[model samples]
Target: MSSFVLVDRPVPEVAVVTLNRPDRMNAMAFDVMVPVRDALVELSNDNSVRAVVLTGAGEGFCSGADQENAGRAPHVEGLGRPGFGLRSLELLEDVVLALRRLHQPVIAAVNGAAIGGGLCLALACDLRIASSTAYFRAAGINNGLTASELGLSFLLPRAVGSTRAADIMLTGRDVGAEEAERIGLVSRVEDPVVDAAVEMGQRIAGFSQPGIELTKRSLHAGMAASSLESYMPSEGLGQLYLRLLTDNFEEATAARKQGRAPQFRDGR
Candidate 1:
């Protein structure tokens, strides 16, 4: 049987993975997390897929972990010291890592509440687009749990700086869609969030696949770089190699002269 994540191809080269548990607010339970990870891995290996859009069914995007299942078996068998919390973290962390490691750019379509680990999932995506009704919260702190689970501490600080991340994590307050966009947490806000993400995915998929893949890698590398100068060599080397080895650049030049769109090579 299929798990809680529903994967489909809505447009050419674009995969949409929707969290299917609306009654539970698409909570990150063990079953959901495993399928989500598997889906991402499958999509990543498919050369036909160039981009992905992740969203939830019904109203909410995801309300973090399903506290109802807190007493379930540990995600890992060896360690019982951290208890149920450790098990939950193991599952949630896997989903977050899968999203981040995906070669294709992922667009998070936050249609409603993205709480706790849900917000972390969005943060892991390359870009985020939310609906006007959407909201975000580090709700775990309010529930007497650590606020930084599922890599939120690392991702939030990088996206909005340490000051904002600290305030959000410490307070566990809700951040509305408008405020989210204003603070650079999200790129766009509209009524139908998934549609906006699909549009963006289409645009991204139209680019040269090799260039897009390399650019994503370079951006992630820049995050860990010590200084601007340190990152430049990586960027410069990638550009030099692409220009000399790939025919896409020459195709682009020819297309520009002819006032037409360049067709990227298949599986590029």
Candidate 2:
């Protein structure tokens, strides 16, 4: 827990991860995530580490994947290992699951601009307490990336509502900390993410472990993954799977390129 990741293995098992790449606004690269996933797994398993807090070292939380790494639509491939693959999206899922699977408490101390994948970091936390200056954004849509990618597709709606999630994520707009609180995306509004996270950690540490763990699981258990089956598909799919089956996908992309709203051919 102390080596690969910066660890302060104190009582109640409070571990903090500084995204460590403030140089590019804490932009995430493969190297950064390896340590991040390692940190998450290490702290999660250590019995002494009862709680975990994630934050960035610089001015931003995380800004998603390295732009140089971006490429075509998700296509799975095996990385030679049985379960491990080199697919970018699959690894993203791995990171998300690692955060979710941890029995110990996890919190996001949003210190600054949590944009793109950075915003997803906040979403990953069991609770998010943002600094007054923190910003929540979804820049993926602006780059032709799916907001659904990086678990945002599933997490945002649960934090807010399906409609509101779509509005922000699809529009690639930034939401302020106050607005995040207003829309029910965050639990606290304050500065110094580490301090806020530690305060919450101390409070929860007073509780029994199982009770805390179960409550956390129960709270987050069913969130994520938009099942269009229950949704009214008339609105939009963000050029989802169905759109790619025909020329409508091209139409949707063209509209976005033209700086206009997508016009799906099917009225309903």
Candidate 3:
């Protein structure tokens, strides 16, 4: 079969990747992670894809790694030998990195449990839209693993500030959808998160592809840009590049006057 991830184009420029294997609560097994990585890379390279929504197949988003296969050797089924000393762990890291490094914006439609590595996956996305039933936890600490694996330590603090991130990570407590929305972990909490995410993705996909991609890159870079002075150079460069190199601004102007959506290439 095709492994645990199901990739589909629900809209012209929006790709929705569903985490299959609802029986395991969409756990990240070796098979699942590898295919997910490949799918993400494929989508990232597709110029027609402008946005992506990552969600679960059933009730849960993802409940971390497969507990049933906890004792299994960290090796791929078909591949001869896994790379690195911590092969499986590093592979999981690659999945998260792929999401962050993707040119298109990714939306995490958190439908249910997002614990341990699952939470890390959501955190890596550009945006998150959670369902009312959704809950987040850093259960790794409670289960004897370090609280801050999979870039959690870096992403959490930047998201909710040091105080909240420290408390959540240290305690390994559950944060419900309401609390998550209040704390800004998710922008919206709706009945069906995927629908909301798709709506947002469609809106984003309507904009100029290069504009959206450049904006995502600039925002990510600005997160570590130290000071406004340091960040302005990158921002200025993007604005200049867009103005001179692309016709998006002119298209936007015409669209605004014409009362219609701007067709990006050649400005229809």
Best by TM-score: 1
Candidate 1 C-alpha lDDT tens digits along 1-268: 1458999888988899999988899987777777788899989999889999999998999999787873344446666667655666666677888888898999999999999989999999999999999999998799998897878898999998899999999999999999999999999897788888888989998988888999889878898899998789889998888888778878889999999999977335
* lDDT (Cα, tens digit) per residue for candidate 3, span 16-49: 9999989889888877777888899999999888
Clashes of 3: 0
CA RMSD of each candidate after superposition? 2.0, 17.6, 2.7
**Model 2 misplacement above 4 A:** 1-5, 10-12, 68-86, 222-268
Off by over 4 Å in 1: 1-3, 70-88, 266-268
Looking at model 1, residue 25 earns an lDDT score of 92
lDDT of 1 at 219: 79
| Model 2 worst lDDT window (10 residues) | 230-239
Over the full model, what C-alpha lDDT does candidate 2 score relative to the true structure? 0.72
| Candidates ranked, most accurate by TM-score first | 1, 3, 2
TM-score winner between 2 and 3, please give it: 3
The lDDT per prediction is 0.87, 0.72, 0.88
Q: How would you encode candidate 2's per-residue C-alpha lDDT over 126-157 as one tens digit per residue?
A: 88888888888888788886766668877888
How displaced is residue 223 in candidate 3, in Å? 1.1
User: What TM-score fits each model?
Assistant: 0.93, 0.74, 0.92
